[model samples]
Target: MPVLLLALIVFLSDQISKLLVRQWLQPNQSVPVLNNIFHLTYINNPGAAFGIFAYQTPLFIILTLAVIGIIIIAYKQFPIHNRLNLKLALALQLGGALGNLLDRIRFGYVVDFLDFRVWPVFNLADVAIVLGVGLIIWELWRKEEKGEAQ
Candidate 1:
């Protein structure tokens, strides 16, 4: 899928979910989805994922914008016409970036709600970003391995 389309979907879905959480739950409230395993917890994160770099909204905002710009430029210029996987990975990264960026711009924080008791709370954007980056890394590693074998 086109990176922009994926980005729009992630951004809208993240924003809508955050809105729903804000409407139906108070900050710090927890609703168990899978007792002891998962919970829908509403929390405002003023920093990067999992509360790291807490309260650095401005820095995160600028960094996200720069990342988005780089993604767009790189995608258009790269010769990956047959590499659907890479394109999808890039799209996912863009989507996740835009999702969190929107949150930072609108509320000065990213709304996080997914809670796995032992882990820091996070949202879909975090999931997408992690998966996208992992995929990209894996792809690059595979390419290097193939080149070395050749």
Candidate 2:
């Protein structure tokens, strides 16, 4: 129940943020919240992260569907014990992937806005995906260390 709720929240937040950005900013127009540090710059990305493999909409859609399917299978296989963080991490990834998938289906691209001076411009969905992956890696490392110490 909690996992579903969290996933729903992430999905809704990502979609809403992207919609608002689309309405407020023109493509390639940027509004800086923190001068020279962060900005909201709208873009339609037709490829993977950092704009690599640009203009491959169909490939991205297929890949996103595959990833979502794998996440669902993995989530179902997780032991029903004290792994709330693991569940939440999967939820985040699932939600984020779905959000981007919808964009690809509807627009042939993903809507990205949040921008930092250094990294590639990305959206809320991308943020959730990265954070989810990071959490999973950290949890696995922690588990391995505990097992080693015992």
Candidate 3:
């Protein structure tokens, strides 16, 4: 499947889940999806991951756009086979970034709903970013092992 299509799926799923959570729960309110393990908690993060840059919306917006631009450029430049994983990772990141960017643009904050006590409140976007980054790192590691580059 095309990376863009996968990204769209991720973005749609994330937004739908967020919308449903918002419709059903109030801010700071949570329902136990799994007792003590998971809860649907609502939060508006006016910042980056883990609430960083809590007051830097403009910067965040600019950064997100720059990232999108870079991804588009990379997609055009990179060879298909070598970049399959990279494109997939970028698509996941793009979907996630767009998801929260939509919230930030519309509501002046990113809506986060998934809550795990071991970790701070986060949403699907965060998951995408983390997983995308992890896969990217793994790819790099595998490349080094193969002496493909570096």
Backbone clash count for every predicted candidate, in the order shown: 0, 0, 0
Score residue 87 of candidate 2 by CA lDDT: 86
Q: What is the alpha-carbon lDDT of model 2 when measured against the actual structure?
A: 0.89
Model 3, 31-117: lDDT tens digits are 888999998889878888789779798888888888878777867876646667788888899898888788778888888988987
My TM-score estimates for the predictions, one after another, are 0.91, 0.95, 0.93
Q: Would you list the C-alpha lDDT of every candidate in the order shown? A: 0.85, 0.89, 0.84
Model 1 lDDT tens row, 1-150? 466687678767877888899999999999999999999999999977567898898999899999989888878888768777778778778888888888898889999999999999998888888887887888889889889432
Name the better of 2 and 3 by TM-score: 2
Q: Number of the top candidate by lDDT? A: 2
Off by over 4 Å in 2: 148-150
Q: Which ranges in model 1 have alpha carbons more than 4 Å from their true place? A: 148-150
- Per-residue lDDT of 81 in model 2: 52
Model 2 is weakest, by summed lDDT over 10 consecutive residues, at 76-85
